[model samples]
Target: MGGKHSVLGNSTLNQSPTIENIQAAYKEGDTSRAQELIKISCGENNRLRLEKHQLLSVAAGNGDLEAVQYLLKEGRVDLPREPTDENPAVVAAYYGHEDVVKELLDSLPGTNWIGLRRLQELDVSDNRLTEVPACFLHCFKSLRSFNVSRNKLKVFPDPWACPLVASLIEFPGFLSECLEVLFLNDNQLEAVPQSVCCLKSLNELYLSHNPGIRELPPELGQLSNLWQLDIEELNIGNIPAEVRKEGPSAVLAFLRAHLRKAEKCKLLKMIIVGPPRQGKSALLEALQTGKVPQMMQNETSIRTTKWELEKPSGVKDKMDSVEFNVWVIGGPASMSTVNQCFFTDKALYVVIWNLALGEEAVANLQSWLLNIEARAPNAAVVVVGTHLDLIDSKFRTERIATLRAYVLSVCRSPSGTRATGYPDITCKHLHEVSCKTLEGFDGLRRLLFQVSCNIKDMSNAATSQKLVGRLIPKSYLLLQAAVLAERLRRDLEDEVQYLTDLQLEQIIEQNPDSDIKDYEDLQTD
Candidate 1:
């Protein structure tokens, strides 16, 4: 374990990176061919598993479902390959290759594989799994960790109900009781089955897409061991006061209002601002959706028919690759509101709106910025100029140039990287169609999600620094808080620490501050 090299039979060999082969495949542009060569090489018995893994890397990058299938289906492919940093089955499932996964599993039984015992950390989210196979149920019993979110399932399998004597060649046995992390999100479940709740050992329960499961059985709360309980897409606008009073304010807020939280119990601040009629409401709708939020526009007016986006956990696991969330904010008139809301125990996010140019917008924005440093002094500000369709071409070009020049001069990384880290300068994205046309809207949504993630990163960095000064143990809470914070603030390296500390104190003082005590206890845990 101390040495870089490993013994492969009687010979000693230097360990080589599998990425080299993957890079070669990428350069060759024949991902399928690369996969074939990788399989043949790996089959050498003395071959490096890392090389085969590299082929998987290439396949995932190219989005080659066939190449991916080959790797997963390979009889020699290590199904439980040392659960290194990435779980192979989870990775395969995450990338949307259910057929290949099933084939791989089916082949396992033929070889008297007593089943994968080390598959506890497996997560098959956002895949194309239509039905829960018996093999999968058996897989989960062995899986201490599993995520089956964002797939096309109508009902969850009763793993416990699985016949104990079911033939391994057909239906695998019910998943064993060690199941811990279960993500059954974005599915078509209308009822919360008694069996699911009976899994008293379950910890994190993500029931985001069961919108029709209108009420949670108080019995669910009986699972006292549960830590994270996500039920975001239930479409219930207001939470009962009884639910709010049951737990700490931060946890209750997550359950009710869908407000972002820091993993380290630090403050979160965000600002949303955008121009008039630029699909801001549409953006909000998408952010609040369970799956990839579908966009709808009026045939006549530029107004959004519906708004208010609630971000649910585990929705992205249903997607093929990286997925994003949309955010919509108001124009200059709402700057005061945005600034005020930015002062919370959450990370800060700023959405800059592009006004059609005539409405007292420029003056209002300048005045708002003058006070932003004073009010929410620690927050990260992102300038998003929306409504490119309505702006004049000449004006758009000039504005982009000006914004690009400003960011490059100020926000450039120490390594002399471009402000956007791209060949281009300004981060501004342009779209032509009105929300009525729904044109270029998907691109816009993707762009906003990208920005949101950046902001979130920044927020997390700030929280991480503060954690070093806190008494809390750096557990998953710190990691999750850091993740949530990062999603709100992309880079906290630029944040003013002293200001964050001062603002956090003020935010706590604004309320009865009972949540502060609860969080303090959580930190001790």
Candidate 2:
């Protein structure tokens, strides 16, 4: 064991710092800052009262061999020979700094590095660490409290076990044996890794404020030691009251009983077409946010939103959280052809017309119908009649019925909705809604979610029933997020209309957020 000497702290010091600060500074390659903080951080005022050996540990963790060399000069600092946090070698090994570990051991003549096999506490939080490197995860066989929170971590490493550790004891369960506290909050994480279930000794988990993080693994219920669980703001909204507001016991019990379901988050193009202020954007806003959309005239809007469905009081795993790439084609008649470019068979279309326009409303509807028929035939369409509030309540039902009949006639006949010979399109349902009163929006929303997820009522189902939805792997979704993030970043730097096939491939291949490298199952949605 290293002797606790007052050599470094023997002089008067101005500041004290926790080990967390040193590790964070080192991680960001702020060597000078770490040195400055460490120099003044001497006495027992902080969590880590830095003495000679602990100061050497900071240098070793940072892979600063020169600092380690200067610190270890001629009994100025005690060299730790034990497996405790005082050991510079263990600190170096925890950060995968083999070079520093070797130099520290070599400096002590006959001394060999005693690795961190039973290190109780490790906190590398407040850094921009994108990953918990597998090599670093290997040696901490007895890691009690681990904190890598407040980092830009998107995903946990695969094979959550280190190869070196795997040969001795089973990987995942080994670390979980003593990992009592885990803080993985405030990251870009999309899905909570299922491997977290391996943490049998995990007592408290802080997973909140992660905007992209949607699904919580049901297997987390297996954590018998978990007393506190904080999960909030998943996908579009907060978790259910029972799970979120209740005690940890209630939350875990709920998760334990909760059935596992994977609604592989579907994304579709939701095209809203209309001329001028017909509440096309309003309809979309109401559907996505469950709030009234302000009626702005002829505004070009393109937005993306998650379909927030109420989850049962149980485990949370991507519950019907479909992402819609909403595109609003709102303009005058001259932009009709340009708008047609957005139409697609896979898209869920909503054609809007101001009911108060009378003959002009019918003509506008007809024109939009023609464009849809020409460009995107047999696509799922929902015809919407806006300005229902303007129509007198006494005649609301009758007026709606009249407009619905006209839409029906247009779709059924081979004749054009106006000209001639217009065949029946895939016009599923027509709903009239008033943007002002927010009437008939519930019906509109219900229909949109239904068609978006391909949910239909089926009677007399079998035991093993095949589900319906645009299901994609969690990997695909993560990849898409990465791609989109990169694309947006590029747009901010330099706006471009389109990306070539080769350019898109480069984006996917270069994405560090996703582990998926294969293009076989890659979806460019």
Candidate 3:
């Protein structure tokens, strides 16, 4: 036997051991040697030179389970009060030793274990953890801050596996009651689970940098306490552009607005019909950009001109705004035959008549309305009297009254035998507009918005009837052949090129088929 050595100085003798020898023994997995050294260090009346926390941390970090247990049980060493730079559990996790990590967590006091506990924050980030350990729920009921970022997690922690959450669902507060901050960024999560909504106290959530997550559950809106939500670098198209430009408040507003019935807001088709040179195109321009066209042309339009107004003003109370497809039919009464083709039960008819021609306004309005009713019965009509600036102040009142009375009488009258062709017509609104002065345009715009919002689900019967009525048997056969040719081009696997309009016309001329000649006039260059 050798003489005893001082606890503070290096061990020169064989009887006393130093902290370096204990660390070396632990790293070598020599539990017996480590235990023998610990016993000599804690010998009766012996001054303690090394801390137990330091010895246990080295044992746990080396993945020596037996050494860790021997030091904790026989050495009478307490668990680390708080995590430090050399935290044993963090080091074990960093080494990918699942058993050592579990053992370190298992040594912590249970929920009922009485003491001055201080284990609240756990940072197992930058590890090879595929999933969070379920034992965390049982051992660390007081855990408030957790960071599992930069891991291989495909989904969130399953709450069903947690015994505390299963047993406390009926209570006001459940598992993770004290959890305030959670970082699950840079993982392979596809969708957020609804269970995260249970974390009522979670204040800040970091879910950005995940490309697989395409859609967020609508239930995320239930997290009322969440203020800082980071969803950057995702492919979520449902979110409006405003959210990315303005921030989280816009996202909240968008979510709240979409929580309604699907049929409440829909696109509306509006047909603007009347005699030519009644400012129909000018009215559309004013409604679109609020700027009237400087030069007015009186030329008849050969084809229908289309304008679309998305999210127009005057109707914002609904969950989503309505889109108006305004089709203005131009040309004289001869062109009105094409108007029947576009008629639909859900359409709103805006009849524009020149108010400058006082008495003639009655005849003009009646002709357009009757033409529209013949095709689209049951259609909602808005009678707009344009060119009011040209009317004299002396006869303005009389002219307006006469026009209103005549239009109402025609709309109210029964079609009799002709009624079988279309639905009953009704005038929903009557207003005078001035394209040059922009006097009554505001009221007309508001009326169009209100009427379009109410109309819904118009039938397609009128469209089918018009198509069938216009084409003969020979002409119809050519149309079907053209349609089949178009479909073939679309469905063909080969990158086959089709002939242009001029080419097709040239081919038809060289062949000279009677059926093709019947539809030749209908073809456009």
Residue-by-residue lDDT tens digits, candidate 1, 318-348:
2222222222334445454653443332233
What is the lDDT for 366 in model 1? 47
Q: Give me the displacement of residue 240 in model 1, in angstroms.
A: 6.6
lDDT per residue (tens digit) for residues 243-292 in model 3: 44546544543443343111122445678877888888888777777777
Give the per-residue lDDT digits (tens) of candidate 2, residues 244-361: 5545565564454342222334556677888877777777677666777765545654444445544223333344454566778776666767767777656777788888876557
Instruction: Report the number of the highest-lDDT candidate.
Output: 2
Position 225, candidate 1: lDDT: 56
* TM-score rank order: 3, 2, 1
Instruction: Name the runs in model 1 displaced over 4 angstroms.
Output: 1-50, 56-81, 85-88, 109-137, 142-176, 180-195, 208-212, 217-233, 236-525
CA deviation > 4 Å runs, candidate 3: 1-50, 80-98, 108-124, 137-144, 156-176, 237-246, 252-432, 435-525
Q: What is the C-alpha lDDT of each candidate?
A: 0.46, 0.62, 0.60
Candidate with top TM-score is: 3
Question: Which pairs clash in the backbone of model 3?
Answer: 346-458, 377-423, 378-423
